[model samples]
Target: MDAQQFLEEFGHIANAPGGVGKLRELILSLAFKGELCVPSNEISATLLDDIERQRLEFNGETRKQRLTRQSNTTTNLVGPYEIPKHWSWVSLSTVGHTWGQKKPEDSFVYIDVSSIDNKAGVLRQSPEVISASAAPSRARKVVKKGTLVYSTVRPYLLNIAIIDRDFDLEPIASTAFAIVHPWEGISGRYLYFYLRSPIFVRYVESVQIGMAYPAISDEKFYSGVVPLPPTEEQSRIVAKVDELMALCDKLEAQQQARRKLQNALRQSTLQAVASATSPHELQTTWACLADNFGRLFHEPEDVDDLVAELKNLAVRGLLSEASTTSPDLEAIKIDCAQMRARYIADGLIRRQKLVGMADCEETYPAHWAVTAFDEVAIVIGGVTKGRDLRGKQVMVCPYLSVANVQRGHFKLEGLKSIEIAADELAKYQVHEGDLLITEGGDWDKVGRTALWRGGVTNCLHQNHVFKARVPSKQLLNEWVELVFNSGVGRDYFAGASKQTTNLASINMTQLRSFALPIPPLIEQQRILSVLSELTKHCNEWCRQMERKQAMSTLLAGAVVSSLTGITIEQEEEPMKAPQTELVAPLRLGTTPDIKAQAPLATILARHHGEMSAKDLWQRFGGEIDAFYTQLKTEVAHGWILEPAPAEMREKLADSVSA
Candidate 1:
């Protein structure tokens, strides 16, 4: 399609999921290919001559050095694509030379790589003025007005900008950049646009070395090819690109405003539904939502919010009719007491000192009785870590850690193993119909519980997890798990858990004392049955939303490919196979294989000290589950150390020195 046709169809593309970004890429691709503007009769001979004259007059020695450096990398030069007949394919160095580095004589404005806003193609923050002695070593390249600055490292980030005017103090940039001083022939804005093009980015990606800190060398960057249009044509192309980009900005703003309005409407509608005082009012509000569902719930997150509100309403007894039979509280209390006494008499559990329920602010149906969790089930703490088993014979068994436990579900992937003594196995082993709850992690994860249906054989849990087993059949494990995963349960856990920084934990005492609203067996089963059907519908709707989002993405890709004559199939190259190591593959639930642990151990040992989990992932570039599996195994064997807090690290250092 022609430029005008493309511009006209831009709205359609921009409205698709992730379409705006793809539209921007298409604009850049078209502009660089000389398809955005009509070809001119003007020749580039005069422009080239003028550029050479200006370069020679500015700094002859610098020009000579650039040429010498370019000569060495001549063999590495590769043309990205053929240019238009009216345009000339020339090296970037011919029209611009990188500015030389200079140490600051006094305090100067330091514009590091982080200072540039890649998306807006401008400086987001003011440069900092530091003393010459305090200046960072990387802050050595000097930028002047009209100079095009492009970061050499991680060129895919597209941290490229043109210095429009001079600063109050001399502006210095990080050595991570190659400061391009365009000669008379090149339009600085045009060069900046080209630098940000997908072709240039792909070229940089191909040549960039190192996975963690990919960068293009100065020689490679300077010697890269540029499609040079006539000087006047270059100006026209820059202006056209700017105008198109501004249109894209407006389109993006319109989309954002629409989304904001939708979100506001959604929140208000949901609030109305939640605040309904009667079933009739709720039905009316829900009917309104259903009528406008297509317009209101366009995004997957919108569906998620709706599902959450549904769950909240379900637990509040608003979703269905309350059972007519009144619960026999005295009979339930007697039965619970007798069950506890029988378990204690059989030596299956220890006799516990009970704590009275604190005054709770929440109210439930009259048919439901408010009681502590211990009244409904027995809460047991999981096996302790680092316990001495010197004389006790032990067997390796698969166990559930905090990672394995999620809200309402168990992640059976990468289930690790632990050594459990033969006699202590029964105490730690998880049984069917048990409710597994996590003790700590981030605050949101503190009270996450899931039902255990014997998915894994002989599965045990770590100390950070707690197990709640219902002694009587009156309460279902699914019902209890639903209660804990609901908003009411989340609020209780958030308020009751001991919070330190971002992490929170709940001890056995807190778990046992948790207040549970118990309904009669018949009512519980009725509520659960309705919840099961509604939840299934919600999940199916969410899956439909997911499929719609995927289709939108595919449609966007197809549009871009069709316009650029670049097939979508060609864009997606197969991912490189993961690097092989001498270590054997890890087998879940098996005894730790020394060979399997060797690669991870070797990697961690090479590092001086503890590293963040993010940094560790960058080094391996493997699947997240694989990385965590290795990490868990190493931690189990004490081959790698966990990260310590600042105070602890300082104390350890001082003790080591002494």
Candidate 2:
């Protein structure tokens, strides 16, 4: 598409997923490919001659000196795409000279890598002036007006900018940058846009060397290819790019404002509904929502919020028109007592005193009775691992771990096998109508439970999971699961769990003591029926949202491909290595006598012998490779056990597949 047509269609494109950012990238790609503006052979020939004459003058200089000089010869460097005959492919060093490193002599304005806003292609703020004596070792490169500073360290960050105006003091840049001084015939802004192109980014990614601190070497960066357009066309491309980028900025700001307004409207409407004290007020608020639903709930997350509100209203008996009748509280109490006595007499459970209802803060409908979880269900713990099952004849059975249980659902992707004695299967085996709950993990994951429908035979659960079985005809498992998965249940579990740093757990005692709101059987059936229908609709809406998001992304890709003639294929993001249990003993590899070592040495020393490499990484923030490198250093010094290579590979593969 032409520039005017692209601009005209931008309003529609900007509403697509990630349209603004993609549009910026597309502009750069087209500009560098000589597709944004028509190339002029007459103008390019004149500029090429002038650049070649300058290159010849510096041919006599030494290799060290030549590193900063332009080259006269065209080395036949091939770019990702074919350019016009008038435009030529040349090394970056052929059109500009890199400024040599110099120490700060006096007080100077210091431009660190962090000072540049790569996305805007400008300095984030004014550079700080620092004295020569106080200057950091990395502050060594000097720059002047028309110079482009491109950070070589972490090139993926695209920290590049061109100096447009003179500074009060001579500007000194971080050594991490390669300072490019464009020749008299070249447009500095044009070159800056070229460096930000996706092709250059891909090239940088291919040549970057380190894991945690990936960077392109100065020699490789200078040798990198760039498309050289005619001097007159370069100015046209730069001006066009500036205009489009400004338009993108405006579009981004407008989108931000629109989202803020939508959020405010959504929050206000939800609050009005939640605060309504009477049925009439609620009906009015709900009606208002229905009228404006198309505008208020534009995203999937908004629909999710609506679904949650619907559930809350249903449980609170606000959804139905029929008013609640007073429940037989005394009769419920008598039935609970009788059920407890029968269980104790049959030796099915131990009789324990129950806590009073005063402990609960929640209020139920008039027709609902408050009861303890233990009064209606039998809560049981799962089998413990690492016991002596190896010594005896055992059956290998699939077992559920904490990972297998998610809120209102089961994730049976990685069911593990455990050896249990054949006779012990009945005690550990899971059955239909059972509610599986997680015992511990992250703080919010303490009580995630889902109903089991006997999907797999001969399955058991680990100690970190708990199974609650409701006696036949007492209460529906689905209703109990719904109650526990609701906000109230989540709050209770969060408050009741034993919390450590970033972790929480709940025991059988706490689970059994949980107070539940129990409505009459008939009322419960009605609530469940309404909830099921609403939940199904919500899930279908979520699926539609996913499809819409996918279509938007595809449309964005199509726009870029059509404009730049380059197909954009999405690549899967690399996953972190999986965490594993450390079975081998660990110790310090370095001697305590050593005065200095790695920065993580102090932290590693504090860890007891039982801690694993993954635990150390969690405690200290660093890339996985760096952690492994430090770990290897300690292992070399006999401070810790070397990890098994086979295990590491297996875990890495698993993570990649997942």
Candidate 3:
């Protein structure tokens, strides 16, 4: 199929567990059956017979090269028409004389099996070796200039490299490997891809003896069956696979680049949107952003950035510019100044001994007054006497803690009850429309405030969270809350905070030092109304996004299930592309639950596919039998996941793989 057609048919398949894997398995199945590419007409019975004769004669004389006889490593005869007319299957050992020794003296480059691609037919560099003392002393395996070296330990790594350079240097390689030097007429690259094809790995993994680190010996490596095509056809298939794989790499890189650019564009647009000063400007910004909203904001971070901008815009009075048309802003400022003077004169409040407001050359709207927050609102410390009353279920009284307050409002869930001395209840009780702020914490979290809309009739807050009660007659609670939570409050809080060892706090003086923009009560309410509406919309947007992400996760999992053939129900037809277990011990890959790990195999047999021994080992691999013994002790004392029979004596096989 063409690239476009393949994508359309199996685009859902990711380079994950099930999706593309199913397609990969199918490709192998077809390739082994001689269906992946067209067969050559040159392959015939006479040519195959000649190759067999050479193979029989070589096997008769070569006792040292004889493969270990294994029931599972038996070879099957291939039909004449099943293979191309000119193609022949021969044992891999037929092409090369053994260069079975390793020598370190020569300038031969050393290669490790780990350096090769286990999944592709390409040899990669071996890990860098630093120890000269560790160099091999045996005569180096002399592979011809065009030889192919296969890492037998992990054949799936597909590390096949063509020996192109005429170097007398002998590279040190693993003993568990077979190097092949292709005969004349057969291209090394063609054989490389064929080795990478699923036929090789599947044959190794299927009849592999033992339960852990299953492997195939050299006998099975050479005797394994492969459908070899004519020399020319082999070259064609190799070229095609190489070209397609390269294109896939390019496509992946392009997609990654596009995603990065989209994220950058979203951030830029969000910044512009926040900086808009007027309704018309905001409208234009919004329109531009909306035009590419679908493409620009697919991720959660983008939505979070948008929310922050929304908060900034709300605090800056851009949420409802029309509300500033009224002239009450100046009137309220004058009233607050008078109130501050009155309080200072009457000794009811503190004087302006704290930091003064910074100078801003640009004047605010004519309808708004730039006044100190303390001048317009009363900032009081909450009660701090609930040390011994944690985690206790008490009567449902309205109580706001630092945890109770969220971004814009209070949360009632998991509310802690407190014993507010009956006589002092009236003094500390919180009412509706009170602004709650954190008194101390990280500098950024210090002034984080939210408006309490009176979820309960009589609630109180702890001393850690400050209470800023707006003068109902002058300032609106919502507007004051927004200012304190916005960039304005953030800047003020950051400046006034005193940072100590691991803690930053804003005292009562700092809270009162904030220079707030005091709008008329009505205009403040209007801005708050606009903010509330937009915030609700943003929240709904967040919910939708979360749902979409959840769906994507599920779909990715479903795609995995489709490829692994783990399911018995053949509910769907084929269409695809690309793109564990083991609990032998509590090692790097093992689980920690010893009691659970102890009976994993028996449990696995009973649970079917619900869970596997591999899962148990993964969960409790570290201590193994010790963990089990401890788990059994815990079970005796009443714990979970322990096998029912505490004395069940099932011996564990040494299935651990290094």
Best by TM-score: 1
Error of 2 at 104 (Å): 17
How well does each candidate superpose onto the true structure, as a TM-score? 0.77, 0.67, 0.48
Off by over 4 Å in 1: 2-11, 38-41, 60-82, 102-110, 128-140, 164-172, 210-213, 277-279, 327-350, 394-398, 412-422, 568-658
What tens digits encode model 2's per-residue C-alpha lDDT throughout 437-474?
99989976889989998878899988889988776454
Ten contiguous residues minimizing lDDT sum, candidate 1: 643-652
How high is the CA lDDT of each candidate model?
0.75, 0.75, 0.58
Tens-digit per-residue lDDT, 1-658, candidate 3: 3445446545544432243444544444344345556776666344445544655654432455544222222244452124544555554554332444545654546666655655544555444442446555532455556777776664554566766555444555556567666655556776666566555665667655655444567666666655666655666666656665565556566667877998889989988897787889999998999898888877656677777777678767677754535445445546666755675676545565534554433334666677556656666567666545555543435567777776676678888877755545654677777788888775556888888776587888888888776654666776777777776677777767898977788887777767777666667777777777877887787776764554344344333223322211122222221111122222121222322322333233334423433344333332344435544443354323444233323444447432
Model 1 lDDT tens row, 1-658? 5557666766567877878888888888889878888888887666876876886687644755566445733422446565676677677777786667798989998888888889888876676788899999898887888888889988888888888767889989888888788887689999998898777877787788889988898878876778888988999999999998998888889999999999999998988887776668879999998898888888767877787777677667777777787666666667667877876786656888986664567777877788888776777778876778899998888989999899888998888888878787777889998889999899778899999988688889888999888766676677788888888788888888898989998888888888887777787787788777877887787777775665466556556755665433222223233332222222222223332323345444446444455455445444545666766666667665543321111123545658
> Quick one: ranking by TM-score, best first?
1, 2, 3
lDDT of 3 at 260: 91
Task: Pull out the clashing pairs in model 1.
Answer: none
Model 3 stretches with alpha carbons more than 4 Å out: 1-6, 9-257, 323-363, 385-399, 411-422, 456-458, 500-503, 567-658
lDDT for model 1, please: 0.75
